[model samples]
Target: MTAITLGHLRDALHAGCASAVARVLDAYEVEVDFVDADADELPGMLDNGEIDLLVSAWLPRDAGFVQHGMRLIGLLYRPVYVWASTKPLGPIDTLTSEQVGRFITVSQDAPRLKAALATLPNLAGTPVETCDEEVLYERVSAAAEAGEALVAMIAQPHALFHTDMLHVLEDAQERLGGEMEARMMVRETVAACADSDMLDELSEMTLGNKVMSALDYTIQVEGVDPEDAAEAWQRGRLVPR
Candidate 1:
């Protein structure tokens, strides 16, 4: 069996997506070993051939990570950053003064959200409270239960999108960084040695936003192991090739 090293960021979502790719590689009799590292380090590892493939790369935002010899072999999905609320919100510019005051986001997303807000003159002065992921979920859940309005900047394909009460607000202007494509990147050596058919299949594979969100919910909310969740999805949803 041919062996390959697959690299990914250390997060449940990334782990689950990587597992799905591993499952696909298994069909080609490829043995996959997973290597988890921070976003900053993974690109250099790929450049050094320490890893054969990266399960995903968020383009434009992480475009700086693309090294000289890296090849993007697949686009897994395109997920957009959204402003979600317990109730429907008017357009970004039309947001009520009260809505603008109630904006919140996770600490990790604060910088991006702030940058987006800065582009909207109407919302430049809006206060955005930052909290940890757990606290953000807790506050959103509480607001949903109380039928109160709370606006938040959340990236899609997230477990939070599983909440039935949460609605993505209209952003026709796409001020919130637009769609980010999650793509698979391979080292030049790996692409040269890999089976062409398997590589083509990988390039054609598509897991849209809905399926990605369900994968996230399964691993993050339902507490399923990423490998198990991926296997179930692979068996149930993915077409046999």
Candidate 2:
């Protein structure tokens, strides 16, 4: 079979995911070439057939990027932004004023989450502290160790989710706009090829929230290289042999 070019965003999580996909293709004795690009450029590359497959593209928000002749072939994972706390907060709406005041988030997510919090009358005017990713992780770890009441806005498939310290609060009203799915995309010609059965297998594969979180933790927290981490996971968990 000819070499298939795979593309992924330039992030640790995406890199790990792409590596895992490559391992799967390797098992099938397929030659794989990788293309790592920024999220903004990846879709265009796929549309132009510069890459045969894209490891992922977030739906709805990224839907505009799926130009003509490109198809989203698989649902890889559903990632959601969630409020997690060391305490059992029940749900987002049920948080006490103090808990709301204790809210914290990484800088990149602060604006979006703050806007979401403002939508609720009860949460309006609440202050959400912001910090860098590293500091946020440290804060959560420290809070968990001290058994303090602290709430943090975090996305699933993140390294922090690998721990059991945080209790995820239910967003009963869906205020967070946390509905997003990461899906595999392919050029139309590739999707129509005789070897497209592999795409079918990939489409049916689902690496639930926990596994993806563990994968991220391996790379981010445990200091494992993305490629090595993916190879370890693919061999140990996804396709043990």
Using lDDT as the measure, the top candidate is: 1
Residue clash pairs of candidate 1: none
Local error of candidate 2 at 70, Å? 1.2
Residue-by-residue lDDT tens digits, candidate 2, 202-227: 87877766667777778767778877
lDDT of 2: 0.76
Decoy 2 TM-score against native: 0.83
The residue-by-residue lDDT of candidate 1 on 1-241, one tens digit each, is 3999989988777888898888889999999999999777876787778888887988877787688888988899897789888887787767765664467887878888878777777665666688976466678777788877778898787777765868888888898877899998888878899899889999998877777777787887778998888988877852232
TM-score of each: 0.89, 0.83
> lDDT for every model?
0.80, 0.76
Query: What number of backbone clashes does candidate 2 have, counting pairs of residues 3 or more apart or in separate chains?
Result: 0
lDDT for residue 57 in candidate 1, whole number 0-100: 85
Those runs of model 1 whose alpha carbons end farther than 4 Å from true positions after fitting are 121-126, 237-241
